[model samples]
Target: MKTLKSRPSAILFSCRARRGVLARGLNTTREIAMPEYLSPGVYVEEVDAGTQRIPGISTSIDRARWQSLVAEFKKTVVPQAPAWTDSNDTDPGVTLLELFAWLTENLLYRAHDIPERGRNAALRAATALSVLGHRCTTECATLTRAHFFAGQLLDAATLQAEQDYHREKLRRHNRMLHGFGIVSGLGVHVEATSDPGGGRVIVDPGYAIDRCGEEIAVCTGATLAFPSVGNEAFVSLRFWEHPCPPDSPSASGEPDVTRVEEACVIGFAQAVSPPALALARLIRADGGWRVDPAFVPPRAGAVMA
Candidate 1:
Protein backbone atom coordinates (compact mmCIF):
# COMPACT_ATOMS: atom_id res chain seq x y z
CA MET A 1 0.00 0.00 0.00
CA LYS A 2 1.26 3.52 -0.96
CA THR A 3 1.23 6.47 1.50
CA LEU A 4 0.59 10.19 0.71
CA LYS A 5 3.54 12.61 1.20
CA SER A 6 3.43 15.98 3.00
CA ARG A 7 2.89 19.04 0.80
CA PRO A 8 5.70 21.58 0.27
CA SER A 9 5.99 24.42 2.86
CA ALA A 10 5.23 27.15 0.26
CA ILE A 11 1.80 25.55 -0.43
CA LEU A 12 0.76 26.36 3.16
CA PHE A 13 0.76 30.14 2.49
CA SER A 14 -0.40 29.89 -1.13
CA CYS A 15 -3.20 27.32 -0.70
CA ARG A 16 -6.31 28.23 1.32
CA ALA A 17 -7.27 24.64 2.19
CA ARG A 18 -4.22 23.67 4.33
CA ARG A 19 -3.27 25.46 7.63
CA GLY A 20 -5.72 28.23 6.71
CA VAL A 21 -8.58 25.75 7.14
CA LEU A 22 -7.16 24.46 10.44
CA ALA A 23 -6.86 27.98 12.03
CA ARG A 24 -10.32 28.87 10.65
CA GLY A 25 -8.97 32.38 9.89
CA LEU A 26 -9.22 33.33 13.63
CA ASN A 27 -5.41 33.68 13.95
CA THR A 28 -4.90 35.45 10.62
CA THR A 29 -2.08 37.46 12.23
CA ARG A 30 0.15 34.39 12.43
CA GLU A 31 3.08 34.53 9.99
CA ILE A 32 3.04 31.98 7.15
CA ALA A 33 6.38 30.39 6.31
CA MET A 34 7.25 30.27 2.60
CA PRO A 35 9.89 28.09 0.99
CA GLU A 36 11.90 28.69 -2.22
CA TYR A 37 11.80 25.75 -4.63
CA LEU A 38 15.01 25.08 -6.60
CA SER A 39 14.44 21.96 -8.77
CA PRO A 40 11.80 20.99 -11.34
CA GLY A 41 10.44 18.31 -9.02
CA VAL A 42 9.94 20.80 -6.15
CA TYR A 43 6.70 22.77 -5.81
CA VAL A 44 6.62 26.32 -4.30
CA GLU A 45 4.17 29.25 -4.21
CA GLU A 46 4.88 32.19 -6.56
CA VAL A 47 5.97 35.36 -4.75
CA ASP A 48 4.83 38.89 -5.68
CA ALA A 49 7.71 40.61 -7.49
CA GLY A 50 6.60 44.02 -6.21
CA THR A 51 7.13 42.85 -2.58
CA GLN A 52 10.91 42.69 -3.16
CA ARG A 53 11.16 46.23 -4.58
CA ILE A 54 12.31 48.90 -2.04
CA PRO A 55 10.63 52.32 -1.96
CA GLY A 56 11.87 55.90 -1.26
CA ILE A 57 15.40 57.36 -0.99
CA SER A 58 15.73 56.19 2.64
CA THR A 59 15.37 52.54 1.61
CA SER A 60 18.45 50.32 1.07
CA ILE A 61 19.06 50.77 -2.69
CA ASP A 62 22.42 48.96 -2.52
CA ARG A 63 20.81 45.72 -1.35
CA ALA A 64 18.19 45.96 -4.08
CA ARG A 65 20.91 46.55 -6.63
CA TRP A 66 22.90 43.52 -5.44
CA GLN A 67 19.84 41.27 -5.55
CA SER A 68 18.92 42.44 -9.03
CA LEU A 69 22.48 41.76 -10.20
CA VAL A 70 22.46 38.25 -8.73
CA ALA A 71 19.07 37.41 -10.24
CA GLU A 72 19.97 38.70 -13.69
CA PHE A 73 23.33 36.91 -13.66
CA LYS A 74 21.66 33.64 -12.65
CA LYS A 75 19.10 33.90 -15.47
CA THR A 76 21.24 35.18 -18.37
CA VAL A 77 24.82 34.18 -17.52
CA VAL A 78 24.38 30.78 -15.83
CA PRO A 79 20.86 29.50 -16.65
CA GLN A 80 21.75 25.86 -15.91
CA ALA A 81 23.78 26.54 -12.76
CA PRO A 82 23.17 23.83 -10.08
CA ALA A 83 25.83 24.64 -7.40
CA TRP A 84 24.17 28.06 -6.77
CA THR A 85 21.22 26.68 -4.81
CA ASP A 86 20.22 29.40 -2.31
CA SER A 87 21.16 32.84 -1.01
CA ASN A 88 21.67 31.95 2.64
CA ASP A 89 24.02 32.59 5.60
CA THR A 90 26.16 29.61 4.53
CA ASP A 91 27.17 31.25 1.26
CA PRO A 92 30.43 33.29 1.61
CA GLY A 93 29.74 35.17 -1.65
CA VAL A 94 26.31 36.27 -0.41
CA THR A 95 27.77 37.40 2.91
CA LEU A 96 30.46 39.44 1.13
CA LEU A 97 27.88 41.04 -1.15
CA GLU A 98 25.69 41.86 1.83
CA LEU A 99 28.60 43.53 3.65
CA PHE A 100 29.43 45.60 0.60
CA ALA A 101 25.79 46.52 0.21
CA TRP A 102 25.55 47.62 3.87
CA LEU A 103 28.52 49.96 3.54
CA THR A 104 27.17 51.41 0.32
CA GLU A 105 23.78 51.85 1.96
CA ASN A 106 25.33 53.85 4.82
CA LEU A 107 27.08 56.17 2.37
CA LEU A 108 23.84 56.72 0.51
CA TYR A 109 21.99 57.38 3.79
CA ARG A 110 24.42 60.11 4.85
CA ALA A 111 24.26 61.69 1.42
CA HIS A 112 20.48 61.76 1.59
CA ASP A 113 20.50 63.43 5.05
CA ILE A 114 22.67 66.38 4.03
CA PRO A 115 20.91 69.68 4.79
CA GLU A 116 19.52 71.62 1.85
CA ARG A 117 20.29 75.08 3.27
CA GLY A 118 22.06 77.64 1.07
CA ARG A 119 25.12 77.98 3.33
CA ASN A 120 26.99 74.84 4.27
CA ALA A 121 26.74 74.46 8.05
CA ALA A 122 29.21 71.61 8.01
CA LEU A 123 31.82 73.69 6.15
CA ARG A 124 31.40 76.57 8.63
CA ALA A 125 31.88 74.26 11.61
CA ALA A 126 35.04 72.86 10.05
CA THR A 127 36.34 76.39 9.43
CA ALA A 128 35.72 77.45 13.04
CA LEU A 129 37.70 74.46 14.23
CA SER A 130 40.75 75.77 12.36
CA VAL A 131 41.04 79.11 14.17
CA LEU A 132 44.50 79.63 15.79
CA GLY A 133 44.17 82.80 17.94
CA HIS A 134 41.74 83.87 20.69
CA ARG A 135 41.41 86.91 23.02
CA CYS A 136 39.89 87.46 26.51
CA THR A 137 39.90 89.99 29.44
CA THR A 138 39.25 89.85 33.22
CA GLU A 139 38.25 93.59 33.50
CA CYS A 140 40.78 94.33 36.23
CA ALA A 141 41.56 98.09 36.63
CA THR A 142 44.47 97.97 39.12
CA LEU A 143 46.29 95.50 41.36
CA THR A 144 44.88 97.01 44.58
CA ARG A 145 41.38 96.91 43.08
CA ALA A 146 41.69 93.12 42.77
CA HIS A 147 42.74 92.78 46.43
CA PHE A 148 41.33 94.28 49.70
CA PHE A 149 37.86 92.96 50.46
CA ALA A 150 35.28 95.38 51.96
CA GLY A 151 34.24 94.81 55.65
CA GLN A 152 37.32 92.59 56.06
CA LEU A 153 39.52 95.04 57.89
CA LEU A 154 43.20 94.46 58.60
CA ASP A 155 45.74 96.67 60.33
CA ALA A 156 48.19 98.56 58.10
CA ALA A 157 51.06 96.32 59.23
CA THR A 158 49.03 93.15 58.59
CA LEU A 159 47.95 94.34 55.16
CA GLN A 160 51.55 95.21 54.32
CA ALA A 161 52.66 91.70 55.36
CA GLU A 162 50.04 90.05 53.13
CA GLN A 163 51.15 92.10 50.15
CA ASP A 164 54.76 91.10 50.79
CA TYR A 165 53.79 87.42 50.86
CA HIS A 166 52.07 87.65 47.44
CA ARG A 167 55.09 89.41 45.93
CA GLU A 168 57.39 86.69 47.28
CA LYS A 169 55.20 84.01 45.76
CA LEU A 170 55.42 85.71 42.38
CA ARG A 171 59.23 85.84 42.64
CA ARG A 172 59.48 82.13 43.41
CA HIS A 173 57.12 81.19 40.57
CA ASN A 174 59.17 83.26 38.12
CA ARG A 175 62.43 81.74 39.37
CA MET A 176 61.02 78.26 38.74
CA LEU A 177 60.11 79.26 35.20
CA HIS A 178 63.63 80.66 34.61
CA GLY A 179 65.17 77.34 35.63
CA PHE A 180 63.09 75.72 32.88
CA GLY A 181 64.94 77.73 30.13
CA ILE A 182 62.17 80.36 29.87
CA VAL A 183 64.72 83.08 30.69
CA SER A 184 62.94 86.43 30.21
CA GLY A 185 60.63 87.52 33.02
CA LEU A 186 58.17 88.38 30.26
CA GLY A 187 57.97 84.71 29.24
CA VAL A 188 56.50 83.76 32.66
CA HIS A 189 52.85 84.38 33.47
CA VAL A 190 51.89 84.34 37.17
CA GLU A 191 48.51 84.13 38.88
CA ALA A 192 47.60 86.42 41.82
CA THR A 193 48.70 84.76 45.03
CA SER A 194 45.89 84.08 47.50
CA ASP A 195 45.40 86.59 50.33
CA PRO A 196 44.52 85.50 53.87
CA GLY A 197 41.99 88.36 54.33
CA GLY A 198 39.31 86.48 52.34
CA GLY A 199 39.50 88.78 49.29
CA ARG A 200 39.00 87.10 45.94
CA VAL A 201 42.42 86.79 44.34
CA ILE A 202 42.22 88.07 40.75
CA VAL A 203 44.91 87.12 38.23
CA ASP A 204 44.48 89.06 34.95
CA PRO A 205 46.52 87.75 32.00
CA GLY A 206 46.28 90.03 28.91
CA TYR A 207 48.37 89.68 25.78
CA ALA A 208 47.74 89.67 22.02
CA ILE A 209 50.33 87.82 19.98
CA ASP A 210 49.90 87.46 16.21
CA ARG A 211 51.31 84.45 14.41
CA CYS A 212 52.08 86.31 11.16
CA GLY A 213 54.04 88.99 13.04
CA GLU A 214 56.62 88.86 15.88
CA GLU A 215 54.83 91.74 17.69
CA ILE A 216 53.40 91.02 21.17
CA ALA A 217 51.07 93.48 22.97
CA VAL A 218 51.51 93.12 26.75
CA CYS A 219 48.32 94.89 27.85
CA THR A 220 45.86 96.35 25.34
CA GLY A 221 43.19 99.09 25.82
CA ALA A 222 43.34 102.44 27.76
CA THR A 223 43.47 102.61 31.55
CA LEU A 224 40.03 102.45 33.20
CA ALA A 225 41.13 104.36 36.33
CA PHE A 226 44.33 105.27 38.21
CA PRO A 227 45.19 104.29 41.79
CA SER A 228 44.35 106.77 44.62
CA VAL A 229 46.37 110.04 44.28
CA GLY A 230 49.48 109.23 46.31
CA ASN A 231 49.50 105.39 46.61
CA GLU A 232 51.26 103.14 44.05
CA ALA A 233 49.54 100.31 42.10
CA PHE A 234 50.42 96.99 40.44
CA VAL A 235 49.19 95.22 37.26
CA SER A 236 49.59 91.51 36.69
CA LEU A 237 49.44 89.80 33.28
CA ARG A 238 49.94 86.23 32.06
CA PHE A 239 49.90 84.62 28.57
CA TRP A 240 51.10 81.61 26.50
CA GLU A 241 53.35 82.07 23.48
CA HIS A 242 53.44 80.20 20.19
CA PRO A 243 56.55 79.52 18.10
CA CYS A 244 55.52 81.83 15.26
CA PRO A 245 52.60 83.03 13.18
CA PRO A 246 51.02 80.22 11.21
CA ASP A 247 51.61 80.67 7.45
CA SER A 248 50.77 77.38 5.84
CA PRO A 249 47.99 76.52 3.37
CA SER A 250 46.94 73.32 5.11
CA ALA A 251 44.10 72.58 7.54
CA SER A 252 46.52 72.57 10.52
CA GLY A 253 47.93 76.03 9.73
CA GLU A 254 46.21 77.68 12.71
CA PRO A 255 48.66 78.86 15.38
CA ASP A 256 48.13 77.44 18.88
CA VAL A 257 48.00 80.59 21.06
CA THR A 258 47.90 80.22 24.84
CA ARG A 259 46.98 82.88 27.40
CA VAL A 260 47.84 82.90 31.13
CA GLU A 261 46.17 84.66 34.07
CA GLU A 262 48.85 86.27 36.24
CA ALA A 263 49.40 89.68 37.93
CA CYS A 264 52.21 92.26 37.86
CA VAL A 265 52.51 95.99 38.52
CA ILE A 266 53.40 98.57 35.83
CA GLY A 267 54.17 101.67 37.94
CA PHE A 268 53.38 105.15 36.53
CA ALA A 269 56.27 106.75 38.34
CA GLN A 270 59.80 106.15 37.01
CA ALA A 271 60.79 106.35 40.67
CA VAL A 272 60.09 102.67 41.59
CA SER A 273 61.26 99.71 39.51
CA PRO A 274 58.37 97.64 38.12
CA PRO A 275 57.16 95.08 40.63
CA ALA A 276 60.01 92.54 41.09
CA LEU A 277 58.63 90.61 38.08
CA ALA A 278 60.64 90.10 34.89
CA LEU A 279 59.37 89.62 31.30
CA ALA A 280 61.15 88.65 28.10
CA ARG A 281 60.11 88.46 24.48
CA LEU A 282 58.33 85.18 23.65
CA ILE A 283 60.97 82.86 22.22
CA ARG A 284 60.13 80.50 19.36
CA ALA A 285 60.07 76.78 20.06
CA ASP A 286 59.84 74.04 17.47
CA GLY A 287 56.16 73.44 18.33
CA GLY A 288 55.30 75.87 21.15
CA TRP A 289 55.46 76.29 24.93
CA ARG A 290 53.27 74.34 27.33
CA VAL A 291 51.41 76.11 30.15
CA ASP A 292 52.61 74.57 33.41
CA PRO A 293 53.27 76.46 36.67
CA ALA A 294 55.79 73.84 37.78
CA PHE A 295 57.19 73.37 34.26
CA VAL A 296 60.71 71.95 34.36
CA PRO A 297 63.16 72.45 31.49
CA PRO A 298 63.84 69.33 29.46
CA ARG A 299 66.84 68.31 27.33
CA ALA A 300 64.80 69.00 24.20
CA GLY A 301 61.41 70.56 23.48
CA ALA A 302 59.00 69.77 20.65
CA VAL A 303 55.43 71.08 19.95
CA MET A 304 55.13 71.24 23.74
CA ALA A 305 57.79 71.69 26.44
Candidate 2:
Protein backbone atom coordinates (compact mmCIF):
# COMPACT_ATOMS: atom_id res chain seq x y z
CA MET A 1 0.00 0.00 0.00
CA LYS A 2 1.26 3.51 -0.94
CA THR A 3 1.63 6.04 1.91
CA LEU A 4 0.06 9.59 1.46
CA LYS A 5 1.69 12.84 2.74
CA SER A 6 -0.31 15.99 3.82
CA ARG A 7 0.84 19.64 3.54
CA PRO A 8 0.32 22.29 6.28
CA SER A 9 -2.64 24.70 5.65
CA ALA A 10 -1.71 28.37 5.04
CA ILE A 11 -2.75 30.94 7.72
CA LEU A 12 -3.39 34.65 7.03
CA PHE A 13 -2.87 37.34 9.73
CA SER A 14 -2.08 41.04 10.11
CA CYS A 15 1.54 41.97 9.44
CA ARG A 16 1.56 43.77 12.83
CA ALA A 17 0.84 40.49 14.61
CA ARG A 18 3.41 38.57 12.50
CA ARG A 19 6.00 41.34 13.03
CA GLY A 20 5.84 40.96 16.85
CA VAL A 21 5.47 37.17 16.89
CA LEU A 22 7.73 36.02 14.01
CA ALA A 23 10.23 38.90 14.21
CA ARG A 24 10.48 38.39 18.00
CA GLY A 25 10.14 42.17 18.80
CA LEU A 26 12.96 43.01 16.40
CA ASN A 27 10.42 44.86 14.21
CA THR A 28 7.34 46.70 15.61
CA THR A 29 5.92 48.25 12.38
CA ARG A 30 2.23 47.48 11.58
CA GLU A 31 1.73 46.34 7.95
CA ILE A 32 -0.12 43.49 6.13
CA ALA A 33 1.97 40.51 5.01
CA MET A 34 1.25 37.08 3.53
CA PRO A 35 1.65 34.04 5.81
CA GLU A 36 4.20 31.34 4.81
CA TYR A 37 2.50 28.05 3.85
CA LEU A 38 4.17 24.64 4.21
CA SER A 39 2.40 23.34 1.05
CA PRO A 40 3.24 24.76 -2.42
CA GLY A 41 0.47 27.04 -3.78
CA VAL A 42 0.09 30.35 -5.61
CA TYR A 43 -0.95 33.36 -3.46
CA VAL A 44 -1.90 36.83 -4.71
CA GLU A 45 -3.12 39.98 -2.93
CA GLU A 46 -5.01 42.81 -4.69
CA VAL A 47 -3.36 46.14 -3.78
CA ASP A 48 -5.02 49.51 -4.24
CA ALA A 49 -3.48 51.48 -7.14
CA GLY A 50 -3.62 55.22 -6.46
CA THR A 51 -3.65 57.50 -9.51
CA GLN A 52 -5.17 60.97 -9.47
CA ARG A 53 -7.14 61.43 -12.66
CA ILE A 54 -7.96 64.76 -14.26
CA PRO A 55 -11.16 64.91 -16.37
CA GLY A 56 -10.83 65.91 -20.00
CA ILE A 57 -12.15 69.39 -20.80
CA SER A 58 -13.24 69.54 -24.44
CA THR A 59 -12.55 72.70 -26.47
CA SER A 60 -15.98 72.49 -28.14
CA ILE A 61 -17.66 72.70 -24.73
CA ASP A 62 -15.59 75.77 -23.85
CA ARG A 63 -16.47 77.42 -27.18
CA ALA A 64 -20.20 76.77 -26.68
CA ARG A 65 -20.09 78.14 -23.11
CA TRP A 66 -18.26 81.28 -24.25
CA GLN A 67 -20.73 81.82 -27.14
CA SER A 68 -23.61 81.62 -24.64
CA LEU A 69 -21.89 84.14 -22.32
CA VAL A 70 -21.30 86.51 -25.23
CA ALA A 71 -24.94 86.29 -26.28
CA GLU A 72 -26.07 86.97 -22.69
CA PHE A 73 -23.72 89.95 -22.36
CA LYS A 74 -25.02 91.51 -25.59
CA LYS A 75 -28.70 90.97 -24.76
CA THR A 76 -28.78 91.96 -21.04
CA VAL A 77 -25.62 94.01 -20.28
CA VAL A 78 -25.60 96.32 -23.32
CA PRO A 79 -28.58 98.64 -23.91
CA GLN A 80 -30.37 97.99 -27.24
CA ALA A 81 -30.97 101.75 -27.85
CA PRO A 82 -27.76 102.13 -29.92
CA ALA A 83 -28.20 98.57 -31.26
CA TRP A 84 -25.64 95.73 -30.78
CA THR A 85 -26.62 93.55 -33.79
CA ASP A 86 -23.03 92.48 -34.70
CA SER A 87 -22.62 88.95 -33.26
CA ASN A 88 -20.03 87.66 -35.76
CA ASP A 89 -16.17 87.68 -35.65
CA THR A 90 -16.24 91.12 -37.32
CA ASP A 91 -17.55 92.51 -34.04
CA PRO A 92 -14.71 93.21 -31.56
CA GLY A 93 -16.93 92.13 -28.64
CA VAL A 94 -17.60 88.68 -30.11
CA THR A 95 -13.92 88.34 -31.15
CA LEU A 96 -12.85 89.01 -27.58
CA LEU A 97 -15.08 86.23 -26.27
CA GLU A 98 -13.73 83.77 -28.85
CA LEU A 99 -10.14 84.62 -27.93
CA PHE A 100 -10.86 84.13 -24.23
CA ALA A 101 -12.46 80.75 -24.90
CA TRP A 102 -9.45 79.62 -26.97
CA LEU A 103 -7.02 80.72 -24.24
CA THR A 104 -9.06 79.05 -21.50
CA GLU A 105 -9.04 75.77 -23.41
CA ASN A 106 -5.28 76.07 -23.98
CA LEU A 107 -4.66 76.81 -20.27
CA LEU A 108 -6.68 73.79 -19.20
CA TYR A 109 -4.61 71.58 -21.53
CA ARG A 110 -1.32 73.10 -20.30
CA ALA A 111 -2.26 72.43 -16.66
CA HIS A 112 -2.38 68.71 -17.36
CA ASP A 113 0.99 68.84 -19.15
CA ILE A 114 2.75 69.58 -15.84
CA PRO A 115 4.50 66.63 -14.21
CA GLU A 116 2.50 64.68 -11.61
CA ARG A 117 4.70 65.81 -8.69
CA GLY A 118 4.79 69.43 -9.93
CA ARG A 119 1.06 69.46 -10.78
CA ASN A 120 0.10 69.24 -7.08
CA ALA A 121 2.40 72.14 -6.18
CA ALA A 122 1.25 74.23 -9.15
CA LEU A 123 -2.44 73.62 -8.32
CA ARG A 124 -1.89 74.62 -4.67
CA ALA A 125 -0.17 77.85 -5.74
CA ALA A 126 -2.93 78.56 -8.29
CA THR A 127 -5.57 78.06 -5.55
CA ALA A 128 -3.75 80.57 -3.32
CA LEU A 129 -3.53 83.08 -6.18
CA SER A 130 -7.25 82.64 -6.97
CA VAL A 131 -8.15 83.34 -3.33
CA LEU A 132 -6.17 86.58 -3.58
CA GLY A 133 -8.28 87.62 -6.61
CA HIS A 134 -5.43 86.89 -9.01
CA ARG A 135 -4.90 84.01 -11.44
CA CYS A 136 -1.64 82.30 -12.29
CA THR A 137 -0.29 83.16 -15.73
CA THR A 138 -0.72 80.34 -18.21
CA GLU A 139 2.39 79.40 -20.19
CA CYS A 140 2.14 78.34 -23.84
CA ALA A 141 4.55 76.34 -25.96
CA THR A 142 5.12 79.47 -28.04
CA LEU A 143 4.33 82.63 -26.06
CA THR A 144 4.59 86.27 -27.11
CA ARG A 145 3.83 89.65 -25.50
CA ALA A 146 0.70 90.03 -27.65
CA HIS A 147 -0.77 86.87 -26.07
CA PHE A 148 -0.61 88.42 -22.57
CA PHE A 149 -2.61 91.55 -23.38
CA ALA A 150 -5.64 91.26 -25.65
CA GLY A 151 -8.50 93.37 -24.19
CA GLN A 152 -7.43 92.18 -20.72
CA LEU A 153 -7.00 94.71 -17.91
CA LEU A 154 -3.53 94.53 -16.36
CA ASP A 155 -3.67 94.93 -12.58
CA ALA A 156 -0.15 95.70 -11.39
CA ALA A 157 0.43 94.92 -7.72
CA THR A 158 3.53 97.09 -7.31
CA LEU A 159 5.61 99.83 -8.99
CA GLN A 160 8.02 97.20 -10.36
CA ALA A 161 5.19 95.67 -12.37
CA GLU A 162 5.19 98.70 -14.66
CA GLN A 163 8.88 98.22 -15.47
CA ASP A 164 8.54 94.42 -15.60
CA TYR A 165 5.74 94.60 -18.15
CA HIS A 166 7.77 96.77 -20.50
CA ARG A 167 10.92 94.67 -20.06
CA GLU A 168 9.13 91.39 -20.72
CA LYS A 169 7.44 92.74 -23.86
CA LEU A 170 10.71 94.14 -25.24
CA ARG A 171 12.59 90.91 -24.47
CA ARG A 172 10.05 88.88 -26.44
CA HIS A 173 10.20 91.39 -29.29
CA ASN A 174 14.01 91.18 -29.41
CA ARG A 175 13.96 87.39 -29.31
CA MET A 176 11.61 87.28 -32.29
CA LEU A 177 13.59 89.86 -34.28
CA HIS A 178 16.97 88.38 -33.21
CA GLY A 179 19.95 90.42 -34.56
CA PHE A 180 17.88 93.51 -35.51
CA GLY A 181 17.25 94.45 -31.84
CA ILE A 182 19.65 95.43 -29.02
CA VAL A 183 19.37 93.48 -25.77
CA SER A 184 21.76 94.32 -22.93
CA GLY A 185 23.09 91.46 -20.74
CA LEU A 186 21.03 88.98 -22.78
CA GLY A 187 24.14 87.77 -24.66
CA VAL A 188 27.88 87.18 -24.24
CA HIS A 189 30.95 88.50 -26.09
CA VAL A 190 34.63 87.60 -25.56
CA GLU A 191 37.76 89.22 -26.94
CA ALA A 192 41.56 88.80 -26.55
CA THR A 193 43.21 91.99 -25.28
CA SER A 194 46.02 93.62 -27.34
CA ASP A 195 46.97 95.86 -24.38
CA PRO A 196 50.07 95.28 -22.16
CA GLY A 197 50.82 92.13 -24.22
CA GLY A 198 49.59 89.15 -22.11
CA GLY A 199 47.15 86.25 -22.56
CA ARG A 200 44.50 88.53 -20.97
CA VAL A 201 40.93 88.61 -22.34
CA ILE A 202 38.15 91.23 -22.28
CA VAL A 203 34.39 91.23 -22.79
CA ASP A 204 33.58 92.04 -26.42
CA PRO A 205 32.32 95.59 -27.18
CA GLY A 206 28.99 94.80 -28.97
CA TYR A 207 27.10 94.85 -25.64
CA ALA A 208 28.97 98.03 -24.55
CA ILE A 209 27.60 100.16 -27.43
CA ASP A 210 24.47 100.80 -25.31
CA ARG A 211 26.44 103.12 -23.00
CA CYS A 212 28.68 104.81 -25.59
CA GLY A 213 27.07 107.16 -28.11
CA GLU A 214 29.10 105.57 -30.93
CA GLU A 215 26.91 103.31 -33.11
CA ILE A 216 27.83 99.76 -34.13
CA ALA A 217 28.26 99.24 -37.89
CA VAL A 218 28.62 95.48 -37.51
CA CYS A 219 27.98 93.66 -34.24
CA THR A 220 29.43 90.29 -35.19
CA GLY A 221 32.35 89.22 -32.93
CA ALA A 222 34.06 88.00 -36.14
CA THR A 223 36.24 91.16 -35.94
CA LEU A 224 38.06 89.64 -32.93
CA ALA A 225 41.01 87.31 -33.63
CA PHE A 226 41.59 83.92 -31.91
CA PRO A 227 44.30 83.55 -29.24
CA SER A 228 47.34 81.43 -30.23
CA VAL A 229 47.19 79.56 -26.88
CA GLY A 230 43.72 78.02 -27.37
CA ASN A 231 41.34 76.43 -29.85
CA GLU A 232 37.97 78.01 -30.85
CA ALA A 233 36.70 78.95 -27.32
CA PHE A 234 33.21 80.37 -27.61
CA VAL A 235 30.49 77.86 -26.76
CA SER A 236 27.51 80.08 -27.78
CA LEU A 237 27.25 83.73 -28.93
CA ARG A 238 25.00 86.56 -30.21
CA PHE A 239 25.37 89.37 -32.75
CA TRP A 240 23.67 92.77 -33.00
CA GLU A 241 22.32 94.19 -36.25
CA HIS A 242 23.04 97.78 -37.18
CA PRO A 243 19.95 99.66 -35.99
CA CYS A 244 20.12 101.82 -39.13
CA PRO A 245 19.58 100.04 -42.42
CA PRO A 246 22.40 100.35 -44.98
CA ASP A 247 22.04 103.80 -46.57
CA SER A 248 19.57 102.98 -49.32
CA PRO A 249 17.94 105.54 -51.58
CA SER A 250 14.16 104.96 -51.71
CA ALA A 251 11.92 105.31 -54.82
CA SER A 252 12.00 109.09 -54.24
CA GLY A 253 15.83 108.77 -54.23
CA GLU A 254 17.33 110.06 -50.93
CA PRO A 255 19.85 108.30 -48.63
CA ASP A 256 18.01 107.24 -45.43
CA VAL A 257 19.95 106.01 -42.38
CA THR A 258 17.02 106.69 -40.07
CA ARG A 259 16.21 104.28 -37.19
CA VAL A 260 13.75 104.38 -34.32
CA GLU A 261 15.57 103.98 -30.99
CA GLU A 262 14.24 101.22 -28.73
CA ALA A 263 13.31 102.00 -25.11
CA CYS A 264 13.06 100.18 -21.71
CA VAL A 265 15.74 97.45 -21.94
CA ILE A 266 16.31 95.20 -18.88
CA GLY A 267 19.67 94.75 -17.01
CA PHE A 268 22.93 95.93 -18.56
CA ALA A 269 26.50 94.52 -18.44
CA GLN A 270 26.09 91.68 -15.92
CA ALA A 271 29.40 90.17 -17.06
CA VAL A 272 32.27 92.57 -16.18
CA SER A 273 34.89 90.40 -17.90
CA PRO A 274 35.02 87.49 -20.29
CA PRO A 275 33.78 84.38 -18.47
CA ALA A 276 36.98 82.49 -19.42
CA LEU A 277 39.15 85.26 -17.91
CA ALA A 278 36.85 85.70 -14.87
CA LEU A 279 37.48 82.14 -13.79
CA ALA A 280 41.03 81.68 -12.31
CA ARG A 281 43.14 80.55 -15.32
CA LEU A 282 42.52 79.20 -18.79
CA ILE A 283 42.81 75.47 -19.46
CA ARG A 284 42.10 73.15 -22.40
CA ALA A 285 38.77 72.44 -20.72
CA ASP A 286 37.76 76.11 -20.60
CA GLY A 287 36.10 77.43 -23.79
CA GLY A 288 35.36 80.98 -25.04
CA TRP A 289 36.32 83.35 -27.92
CA ARG A 290 39.97 82.47 -28.66
CA VAL A 291 42.54 84.82 -30.27
CA ASP A 292 45.92 83.78 -31.64
CA PRO A 293 48.43 86.55 -30.91
CA ALA A 294 51.10 84.96 -33.16
CA PHE A 295 48.92 85.22 -36.30
CA VAL A 296 46.29 87.92 -37.03
CA PRO A 297 47.05 89.58 -33.65
CA PRO A 298 44.43 91.98 -32.26
CA ARG A 299 44.94 95.58 -33.33
CA ALA A 300 44.51 98.59 -31.03
CA GLY A 301 41.37 100.78 -31.53
CA ALA A 302 40.16 98.40 -34.26
CA VAL A 303 36.46 99.37 -34.20
CA MET A 304 33.94 96.96 -35.73
CA ALA A 305 33.63 97.68 -39.49
User: Could you give the C-alpha RMSD of every candidate to the true structure, in order shown?
Assistant: 36.8, 28.6
lDDT of 2 by residue, 116-186 (tens): 45433433332222222211122324432323456776654433466546655544333333412233322
- Backbone clashes, candidate 1: 15
Q: What's the TM-score of every candidate structure?
A: 0.15, 0.19
Q: Which residue runs does candidate 2 get wrong by more than 4 Å? A: 1-156, 179-198, 208-232, 235-305
Can you write out model 1's per-residue Cα lDDT over 164-242, one digit (the tens) per residue? 5565444344333332221222333222223221111122223321211112233321111121123222222212221
User: Cα miss at 175, model 2 (Å)?
Assistant: 1.2
Span of ten consecutive residues with least summed lDDT in model 2:
22-31
The prediction achieving the highest TM-score against the true structure is 2
State residue 120's C-alpha deviation in candidate 2, in Å: 35
TM-score of 2: 0.19
lDDT per prediction?
A: 0.27, 0.28
